[model samples]
Every structure is written in C-alpha cells, then in structure tokens.
Target: MVQFSFFVLPLCFLFNSRKIDNENIKTLQNDSFMRYINLESLYLEDNKLTTIHPGTFSGLGNVHWLGLMGNRLQTLDGGGICHDAPSIRWLSLGNNKISTIEPHAFDCLSQLSDLNISLNPLQSMDEDVFEGLDRIKSLYVYTIYYTDFSTAMFDNTTNLDHVYFSKFRYCNFALHVRHCEPNSDGISSLEHLLARGVLRVCVWVIAVLTCTGNTCVMIGRSLMKHENKVHSLFIKNLCASDLVMGVYLIIIGTKDVVYRGIYNRHALEWKESFGCQFTGFLAMLSSEVSVLLLTYMSVERFLCVVFPYRDRRPNVRQAAVVLIAIWLTGFFLAFSPLIGHGLGYFDSFYGNNGVCFPLHLHQPYLRGWEYSAFIFLGVNFTSLLIILSAYTGMFISIQRTRRSIASSFTTYVGQATNGWIPDIQRKNLRTTALSGSMYAWIVIFILPINSAINPILYSLTTRTF
Candidate 1:
C-alpha cells in the first residue's frame, strides 16, 4: 500500500511538470501560446503587432482574463475572439491604436463581465459591434473620439448596467443609452409640465379652425342645395374625422402632462394606471383610423369623378359603416400588441419624457426572437407602397378628368345657341374639379403635417387657443 501511494504522487507531479513545460514551450511562439497553453491569464501588452489574426484566441478555453493594452492594433479582424472562451471574465484592451472595431469582433466571450477599452485611439464603433455581449456588466470606454450614440448603436445589449465614458474630449457628443430601466417618474414630470401649457393653446386653435372651416363647407354645400347626398356625406365624414383627430390631439397633450408628473413622482402604479392604458389605446386607435378614413375619402373622390353614374356612391349609412370599420381595424391592430406584449409604457429618450409609447418589439432580440427587424421593415414598406400608389392613381385620374372637361366644354361652346351655357358650365366644372382636387391634396399632405406639429405646439401653449 505504501509503495503504491508513493508511486501515484510522483506520477501526479510528473504530469503537472509536463503540462508546465508544454506551456513554457508554447509561450515562445505568439500564436501557439494562445492555441496550446491552458493559460488562465494572458498579457500581450507593449507589442508591435499592428493587426491580430482572425481567431487569435481560438483555443484559449481556459483563459479567464486577457490584457492586450499598449499594442499598435489599428483594427480588430473579424471573429478575432472566435473560440468559446466561457471562462474569460475580464478583458483589457486599453492604450491600443485600435481605430475601428468590426461587427461581431467579440462574438465568443459570453462570460465576460468586465471590459476596459480605455485610452485607445478608437474613432468609431459599428452599431452591431457588441451585438451578442448581453452578459457584460461593467464597461469602460474612455478615449473613443468620434462616435454618435443613436438608438441603433446599442440595439442588442439589454443586460448592460454600468457604462463609463470617462475622459471624452469631443464636444457635442451624443450617447444614447438603450434598454436601461424605465425612468417613469422623470419622464412623466417633464411631459406633464409641458402638456399643461400646450393643451390649452391646441384646444383653442383646433376648435376654432376645424369648427369654422367645416361649418363653412357644410353651409356652402347646403346653400347650393346640393342634389348629391353622397358628396354632402363625404364632406361631413371628412370634417368629423378631422374633429375627432383634433380631440385626440387634446387628449394626447393632457396625457403627456400627466405622464411627466407621474413619472417624476416615481409612481409606478400611476405609470401603469388604467387611464394611461386607455389614453394610449385611444390615441393609437384614432391616429390609425384617421389614416384609413383619409384613404377612404380619397377613394370616394376618385370614384365620384371616374364613375359618377355607377349608382354606387356611398351614402351616410355606407360612410358610417366605413368609419366603424376603420375604427375597429385600428383598435385591433394597436391593442393586439398590448394583449401579446406588455403595455405600451416606454420611457422616451428624446426629451427624457415618460409616457406610454409603443411596446419595444426589439426587446426580445437577445432572447432569440428577432421580431423588430421584420416588423419595422414590413410596416414601413407596406405603408410607403400604399400611400404612393394612392397618390399616383389619384393624380393620374384628376389629370384625365381635367383634360376631358376642357375638351368637352370647348366642343359644347361651338354648338351652343346661348353663349352663357359654355361660360356657366366651364366655371362650374372648374370649381368642382378644383375643390375635389384641393381636398384630396389636403388629406394627403396636411393631415400628416398636422399630426407631427400638433404634439410640439400642444406642449408649449399655456391656454386653450
């Protein structure tokens, strides 16, 4: 038994010595040192190396820390740290000449918790450079000179907590911090204060202009004793939609004010209040419904001119049905996100406002569901095509109608016994065509502009103007 024990101990020591000797031999060759050594820590400082080979740390599975400071590396090659170095927890690449980091440069260091890349000459970092680094806890980015931090820069990281941007020398540097905790109170306070002032002015402006313009249009049509009830109904629907949109604008203004106040107070319950949810739902629903209604109105105008005698003109009943459909569709689309995802309570980074925005579909990217890419692309493309097609078709149809009217009036005048018939008919046709065309143009252009501008103006006004 004694002899056996003594022999086993000697064998164990011999094995350890052999491992050390192998590592010692690997350190002679720079590449082999990374490949063969069971190194727990590596220091590659003060190297004259200007570029690192791809997969430089491909086989360093046991490496727990790596320091590549004081190197002349100008760029990190693609997949420079390719191996699954799960044990690596700390990385220091400070004092390097790295000017650019390729996307996915640090793809394999999932276990990394601390990273220091300070004192580097890095001028820029790609948006997806740190795409898969969800586990990173502390980051030190001290000397990056030229990089704009937009929403796209931190598109992937959701778990990042502490980030240090020390010694920044550039002016007007913008750093967008994404996926941080919701600062509901801070955002709510600012929004509420702004909203109170803006809502008063918006309510007054929208009420006066919309009411006056719509009332004049309605009265003018009535005074003419318009025979076509469909045209009158179309006018009414347009006015009604505009009025509803304006009311929603007021609601949105108030919501912004309330959200800011609640967020500043750090009232989580208030932030998630039913009033907030209802307001969000109503705003989204109205905005979407307005778009659909505007589209419907455009189509109605096109049909009235293109096929006037088709006996298919929409009456008040039909218009109501169409409006209801629009509302239902909008409600379903906007509220669907709420049922599947969480409430649309998101902190706005634009002005540090805490109001309910749309649910961030990109939140699940780190969890393996890449929904944001497809949704963003699909929605924008579809909307663009729809809007473009509608506008093109409307313009083409209007031009054809105008030319036909000009030719018809010219021919009618030559055969008319009364000179007044040609003049009267021409004037009437021109007025009708101009009115319809102008209305369509307003729907296409003015509505979007109004939606965009109302939010800002509503936030600044102090009284209901």
Candidate 2:
C-alpha cells in the first residue's frame, strides 16, 4: 500500500513497494532504484536526469515497464542496468536527449516487446542499438534528424511486426513500412500532399470569388432605391448563405497552407484540440443553413409567381423566425454526435486526416446520424424538385399571359396595328424566355455547382488530408 508520487524521496521507504511512480524527479542516483529489488514497474518520465549510471537498474529483477520519457539523458551506456530484470517488456525513453547508445545497452532485457525512443536526437541507428531487443514487436523512432536505416539497423529485430518511422523517405524500405504523416487517413503522404496543394490553390480562389460575389449581391440589394421587397429578401438570404460558405472555405484553405509550410506533419494539432471539433461543426452548420435557405428562397419565388394576387412577402419578424429555425435545426444536426445520438461518439480520428471532419454516414455504430443522412438527402432532393417545378410553372404562366395580351391587342386594333402588335408581343415573349433561361441556369447549374464543389473539395481531403 506504499503510495509514492511526484518527487517522493527515501529509497528505503519505496523498497517495500512493487511499483514506483515518482515521475518528474529531477535527481536519480545510481543507487536510488537498487533498494527496490521487488519493484515490478517504475515510471520516472518527465524528469531532468541527464544520464543512466552503469548499474542504475541492476537489481530490479521483476520490473516489467520502465517509462523514462521526457528526460535529458544524453547517452545510454552499455552496462548491467537491467541484468536482473528478466520480465521487462515495455520501455519508453521517448522525448529524451539520447544522442547515442553504447553497444548492447539493452542486451539484458531480452523479453522487451515495445521500445519507444521517438523524438530523440539519435545521430544514427544500427543493429547494435537494438542488440538485446530481439523480441521487440513495435518500435516508434520518429525524430527530427535523418537516419539512413542501413541494412543492419533492423537485423536483430526479427520479431518486429510494426515500425513507426518518419514520413520522409531515406530509402526504399522506408516507403514500404507504415509511416505517420500529417495526413494519417488512408491516403499516402504523397497523394495527400498533391491533393492538398491543388486544393489550397482552388479553395482560396473559390473563397475569394464567393465572398466578392455574395458581398456585391448583398450590397447592391441594400443600396437599391426601389428594391422588390420579396425578391430582395430572398437574394439577401441566399447571399448570406453563400457568405457563410465562403468563410468556411477560407478557414480550411488557410489551414492547408499552414500544414504544408510552417507546421508540416505536426500540423495535426487539431486532432487533440477543440478547434477540430468546433470547426467541423461550424462548417456543417454553414452548409446546412445555405441549403435550407436555398430551398426557402426557391419556394418563396414559386409562391410569388403562381399566386400573384396575394402578398407572398414575409416581413422582417417572420423572416427572423424562419432563419432562426433553420439555424437551430442545422446546429442540432451538426452537433448531434456530441450527444451520442449521431455518430455515438466524438472521435478525434473521425477521418484520421488531422482535420476535424463531420461524422461520416458510412462510419460504424452511427445511431441517429445514419438516419440523419437520409433526411439530408431527402430534403435536398425535395428542394431541387420544387425549384425546377416552380421555374417551369413561371415560364408557362408568362407564355400564356403574353399570348392572351397579344390576342386582345390584335382584336382591338383590327388590321391597322395587327402586324405591329404581333411583333411587339413576340419581342416581349423573347425577353421573358431569355430571363427564364437565365433563372433556370442558376437553379439547375449554378446553385448545384456551388454545393457540389464544397463536397468535392472535402472528398479531395482524403483521410485527414
């Protein structure tokens, strides 16, 4: 029952314990751990110890796990440090100042399974460095400096199943092994980089254009002297949605740039931070809001065209309510994963690409989120149908109205103005047709194009790319 933690001293008192968890202890003498002969595990990580005395772990026969990560140890001397520790299995000397290792330094620990010396400044690596780790299964050796991984570097590690090295290629063997990069999703680093480079350029350009186009639309509508109140409102809402999309694109584009340049592979900072989840949620929210607003605008236009007698315009208060509802629904849908109703969990490794992506419908164990995906598809399809039907009805109504007017005018003018009236009616009809054609293009192509590009941009970001 001896509990020691965080800089506890007196080797005599800790000798009775089977585990010693005195991490962050700056001073560890050669004999400090000698008295703990029965110790099964020792955690001395995050300390200031600069070296390991020849016999520091001489008598810890039963120690199975040794965590000396985040230390200042410069060299690991070849000695009988763990000669008595026959049961040692896991050793973590990661994030240390170990620049080199003496031959057969760990030869005593023949049963070691995992050796994590990652983030160390080791000058080189060879078979002698892992002389005793014949049974090592997983080795993590990520570092800043370059190691040419000579033929003999892994000769002693016959049982090694996985080796995590840097993403940079030093040799053909490095390429064959699993390498961790900023993009940890399924895609390879080269493919990820290629796609990201292209996306970085495209997204920024699209973002700038979207922002400018949407802003101009909003400003023009606002400055108009006799703006069509109903049409103006719909345009404003559409512009607002596009603006949100533009902002989201800008953020992701900037992140891509940073990841390629300054941050490199470490740019996956979003994986462990709240930024990943928040940004992902916000992006989804913006997209959903834009889609819903588009639907509302199309239906509003439809009502105005079909029922021209009544006032189909919504006031500011009514508009506010609808916008609020749309936003609230979007928010709920976007963040449902946080409440266990969607993906059923908030996974930082959602796509394993370092980007906090929305929960994919194809992901496993999705409770309500799977159904939510179907709902999204249904709404989008229904909205598109409404837009198409509305625009079609408008075209038919305009054509009928023009023909009726032309007939009445021809009848009233007899033969004197019949030719002139027909010509005027034909010109008017042409103008209406042209206008409808442009509206159809916007609905059938432009709107869908904008929405389509966003997902395409995202899909290009394979696995966390």
Candidate 3:
C-alpha cells in the first residue's frame, strides 16, 4: 500500500528532511507514515486527532520526538506509537483526555530521554507502564491530581533526573531522583504543611478563637434570657457547627506539629488516611450547616425587619425540627461523595489534596469534579443567593423604616463599623495561581478565620464579648 497515497486533512507539514508537522490534522490511519522512515520528529500538536492506530508509525525507527498535546486521545494501550521508534527521545501527550496507560506502553522507547504526559486526566498508571524505559531521565507528567500511581510505577525509571507532579508527596515514590518540580505545595513546603511560620501561628490562633468564642457564645446565650428562646437554640446550634470547624482546624494544626519537618515522607499517607477523610467530612458538614443556619438567621431577621407585624418566628418545636433537618441535609451533602456514589467515589473524593477538602479548582481533571461543581455551583451557590437575598431585603427594609420612622443610617452603619473596625479585617485570600499547591492556602486559612469571626460577628450587639 502507498503510505502517503491519501493525505490527512488539514495538510500535515513535513519539515526539513527530518520531521512531519500536522496542523489540525484529524486522523491517522494504520501505516499512515510507513514511508517516513528517515523522519526524526513528528508534531501533531493541538490537532483534532482522536486515535493513533497501533503500527501507525511502524517503519519510523529513527523518529525522536512525537508531539500529541491538546488532543482528545483518552487511553494508551501497550506499545502503540512508541512501537519501532527506539531512538525517540522526547514525546509529549500533554493536555489530552488520557485516563489510562496500559502496561509497557513505552516498552520500545528504550533511549527516550524526555517523556511528557502532563495535563492528561490519568485515572491510574499501571506499575509496568514505563517498564522498559530505564534510560529515560525526565518525566513531564501529572498536574493531574486524582490519578494515583502504583508504588512501583517508577521502579524501572529510578534514575529519573527530573520529575513533575501535582503533589510534593509524589516525590517520595521517585526516591533517588533528586530534582522535583515543586519543592513545596504552598500551605505545605518540603518541611511542613503549614509552611510559613505566619500560617502556623494563624492556625492555632484561629482554632483557639473559634473554639473559645463559640463556646462562650453557647454558654452566654443559654444563660441569658432572650425574647425568642427557640431562636436562642438555633444560635446555640450555629455555635456547635463553628465548633466543629475549630476542632477540624486544631486537628490539622496538631498534625502539622507531629509531622513537623518530615511532611514529605508522610504527605501521601496522611491524605489517604481515614483521619483526613473524617476531618474533611467534618469541614464540609460544618460549612454547609453553617451556611444553612446563617441563611435561616438572615431570613428570620429579614422577616422581622421588613414586616414588623407578622409573626414568622418558629416555635421551639419548629426550630428544633428545622435545625435537625439542616444538619441532616449537611450530612447528606458532605457524605454523598463517600457513599454509594459511582466508581469515581472509589478514588477518595476528599483524599486528593493534603487538606482532604475536595476543592480542585487548581488541579486539572480531578475526579469528582462533577460532584464538587454541583456542591460549589449548585447547592452552595443557591444557598449564597438565598443569604444575599435575605440580607439585601433586610437592608432595604432598614431604609424604608428609616424613611417612615426617621431612623438614622448612623445607627446601622455604626453597628457594622463598630463590629468591623477593631483588631481585624477579613482578607479574601483568593489566589490566581493555577497550581493546587498555591490554592490550598485559601481553604486552610480563609475558612477557619470565617469560623472564628462568626461568633464574634453574631455577638457584636450582645455583652457576650
């Protein structure tokens, strides 16, 4: 068969004596390049090509580089493109939809020096994927978070001089390999999860404040008499929710101490452990329940302020039922990823990052992105809208009441200003960095501070402080 008898659409560019460049090429039939025997490099980058039939490059024995980045290829079975390409040194399949690479996929590329499989949504890598590539020096893979490598995945490639991954924990697997892309995962450096002294100090401080402040609020609210005793129960429950967050923070902080300088050695194990997952569950439950409780509190305040004559406050029994339902809903939201979820749940939804929270905004193609999106963009987003609507209505009501009853703006602004002006201002701490290492700090720092502030914000008008 004439190998180039038919040309691939989008006109593949064959470069100076040694290469073929396919610009937006769509497909490559078997034996497509049988005549390109002397070609040294092939660039099919950023193309719409989906599959590269095995034996497609059967006769290209001298080819050195193959660029398959930004394509739709999903899996690599054994010895596909790398077949017959013994001298191939650099091969990139980055930004593809790859999920699986069968054993000995690179079995023939013995002289391959640099292999890039980065940005591929790899599900799992078999221990023998790189079985025969003992001479390879650099591995440009990962930034794909959910994928777990078999402990022996690098047993053959132990001489790796350069390695890159989404987690610093991965370094432990490639032991003798000295140079690793990320020395630290921001919240955690090679030395500690709370890498910065400031972060370490902040963790303990916020945990103490959150636990202490919420405890004080609960005790004070119970001891003092309020017009709405049922409402007081709701406040007590909110404190309990915040207290869980405090406990979660303390656990993280304590582990930061226990594992102090050897975080890298234990990073992977810690994230995969049951203790981490439970704290994650604790965090999700506390976060969702707290959101619901705040929405409830805001809705009640909106009603009382906007319609002074209407009796909308729930009785003790009603409040109890509502609180129970809220906690139950939170449990459902938090535990949904762990129970009866489809195969994706097997990946350990919360276990991807060190903190055990499944917020993978920074990690590429992480498993459970659908569920996380549903929670962040679906449930939590809806809750945010409700809370905003309640607060906005309450603010509008204050304006109207002021117009009618001549109440001054000073009264409300003064309260907010007074609550905010002393000793602290909330920092948004959002990051623009694409690395999961950088973004994990937002979760580690911001959420705990919010928990610490909740009781203080709630008790601003009271003598509890």
Candidate 4:
C-alpha cells in the first residue's frame, strides 16, 4: 500500500536532492530507486512502511545518507539496504518497532559511520548481532529493557568510539569506547559514591575507629581477669559482632576507592556481584546480632537490679547456648534473602545499591520489600521494644545504670526502624523521606558506632558496680 506522487520525483532526483519524506509511503517495491541515479540522500521519515522486500533499494546509486526514522518498521531484513551503495555512511533507523535485525542485514553497508538504533523495543540482542557493520563508529542506544546486556555486544565493532546509552549501568560493557554520555546518576559519579568529599573521608574514619575500638575491647577482655566469666564471654561475642560491622564498612570504603572515577562503568556489575551480596549479609549479621546482644545484656542487668534477691541469671553453659542461638538466628535472617532469591522472593536483594547497603529508602516498595520490611519492622522493632523495656525496669530500681541504658538505646534507635513501618513506607507520605542522608549518616556514624561504643558502654574487664 505504498502511495507517492511520481509528478516531481524525477525533478528532485535530477537535482541530487535529499527528501522523499512527509508522504504516505506505506511500502517500497523492488528497484524503487532504479531510475534515481543522481539521488545522494533519501529521507523516508514518518512513514507507514511496515516491511521492505528484497531489491527495494537495489539500484540506489551514490546515496550516502538514509533516514528512515519515525516509521512502522518491525524488522530489519534483506533488501532494505542499498544493493550497491558502499558510499552510504550515515543511517538513521530510529523510532521504529525494530525488535530484530536479521543476519547480514547491514553486510552491504560496510561504510556506515553512524547508526542510530534508539527508541526501539528490542529487549535483548545477541553478542554478534551487529556482525557485518565493521566500520561502525558511533552507536546510539536507548531502550526500555532492563536486561543485563552482554559486555561483548560491541566487541566486533572495533572502530566504535562513541556510545550513547540512556542507562548509566550499560557504560561498563562498552570497553574501548572513547566517549560515553550521561555517566553520573546524581549519587554516584566518577569521583565517588557519596558525591561529597567529607562523606568519603568519614567512611574510612568510621571503618578504622570501629575496627580499632572493637579489637581493643576484645584484646583487653582476653588479657584482663574479670570476676564474672559469663559476663566476659557475653562481652567477647558482642565485640565480635561489632567487629563484623567494621569489616563491612572497610569493604564498602575499599569498593568506593576501587571504583572511583569510573563508578558508573562498573556500578551495575558491582551491585549485582557476589562481593556486594556478602558485604550486605555482613551488615545485616552484625547489626542484628549487636542489637540482640544488647537486649540480652540489658535484661540481665534488669534482673540483677530489680529482682536482686532472686537468682534469675543463667549459668555459663546456658549463656553459651544463648550466644550460639543468637548467632544462628542472625545468620539465618541475613542469609534468608539469598535462599528466598532462589524461590523468586527477591532479585539481587543485597545488591540493590552502589554501597551494597539495602536501605530501600529511595523506594521502599521496590523489589523484595516484604523481606526487608520483615527484617526492619518485625525483628528490629521487636528487639528495640525489648531493650527499651529492660532498661526502663532496671533504671527504676538502681538509677545507677541509666547511663548504659541511654547509650544502648541511642545505638539501637540509630538503626532507623521508624522508617520501616508499612503504614508510612511511601516516601511521599511525609513529603520528605530519608534517601541518601539516612544511608550516609547511618553508614558513616550510626551503624559503625554500635561496635565502636561497646568498649565504652559495657567495659567487661572492669567491675559491673
């Protein structure tokens, strides 16, 4: 159903003109341009061309530029390209329903310098999909697909120097590509993830202090003779949990350094990597175990102060069992996402962010929201309540342990369980929700401080009086 007035076609072709566009061109028949030998450019934009049969462009001589944008082109197959036009350098096939590009579709157009394949529904592409385009230099890609594109998609395009991708994540695979546009995603840049110099320094400082403080506490506990061995054991385990937090921070800081400058290039790969998953697991394990350990200690202190006459404290063997159980529980909770991922419960739960921290504050209802909600609202909220009650009861009796209670309360509250409530999970619920500010503050100061403050809060080597 191709319609075009042949009245002025020969006159325009005689003058070596460039436009056959803005017409109701539904299709092109074989040897459509056989007589137009002088035509150097052809623009068939905004047409209803559904398909092009073999030999449609067979005799297009000297045509170097072809613009087929804003068409109903579904597939790029045989006979669409000029049969003998080796001079065709610029080809614009954008804004079409192009989901497939048949083999050798562009084999004849070896001199094509720029290819605009943007705004198409091509969900995935094979590694060697652009096999014949040896001289392709610039590729424009902007798709609605979320698939992980293969890194070797442009390996055969050896001359390709300029790549324009809509998503920053795709920049990683375009190796040897000289120029890639839109490299920054606001929070992450080539220089750093935090985007601010102060936060970058703070991450390293927190990591060092957290590890140093916990290590000192552990060393002092082992060397000094504490009157209560069970108390010493509890303190040792708490320090170990905090040490894990420090390790998590150290890993995060290292990753930021390793990926600085070219952050977007490796952003997606790093986020979906095993290292990120493990780091996030470490964060969860450390944070939860630390909270639980503090709760246990608070209750132990509460029993000693309020019911001082009663022998409610568990023996060393029972305490050992409790520590083992607490660790196992933390491990299970942290590792649950990995297991649930296999069962289709999550997709890269731990690898959701650049820092590998699964805060989900940006979009709380995003993928795996239920699992995160359970961890934050169900487990963490309950632990906070237990710790608060234990400290409150103990403070009423002795009034001396108020200092320890306040520090522990502040530490647990800093985890930000208030943001996890399902009722207000939406960021718009309050008009301003914590995004990177909460993540930055927690990672730099609050989260690491859990282990950093243990040595100060509960001095195991010293008398508990």
Spell out the clash pairs found in candidate 2.
353-463, 353-464
Ranked candidates, highest TM-score first: 3, 4, 2, 1
- Which ranges of candidate 3 are over 4 A from the true structure? 1-102, 105-113, 117-125, 142-148, 166-176, 398-438, 462-465
Alpha-carbon TM-score of each model against the true structure: 0.41, 0.46, 0.72, 0.70
lDDT for each residue of candidate 1 in 206-297, tens digit (9 for 90 to 100)? 54565455455546555755465654554454445445555544554554445454333332343345554554455445445545554554
Which runs in model 2 stand beyond 4 Å of their true positions? Answer: 1-194, 261-264, 311-313, 338-344, 348-355, 359-372, 389-465
Score candidate 1 by lDDT: 0.46
Tens digit of lDDT per residue, candidate 4, span 304-412? 6677789567888999999999999999989888776645456668876666666565546546867776776677767767867876665566656455744454444
Q: Report the candidate with higher lDDT, 2 versus 3.
A: 3
lDDT of 4: 0.71
lDDT (C-alpha) at residue 191 in model 3: 66
On lDDT, who's better, 1 or 2?
A: 2
For model 4 the local lDDT of residue 50 reads: 82
Name the top TM-score candidate: 3
Pull out the clashing pairs in model 3.
none
Q: Model 4: residues >4 Å from true position, as ranges?
A: 1-11, 14-36, 46-48, 82-86, 144-146, 185-199, 217-238, 255-277, 288-319, 336-354, 357-465
Instruction: Write model 2 residue lDDT over 276-394, tens digit each, in one string.
Output: 55655665566567667656755664465567678546886788788889878877866765454224344433222333443222222222334334434455445545655655665
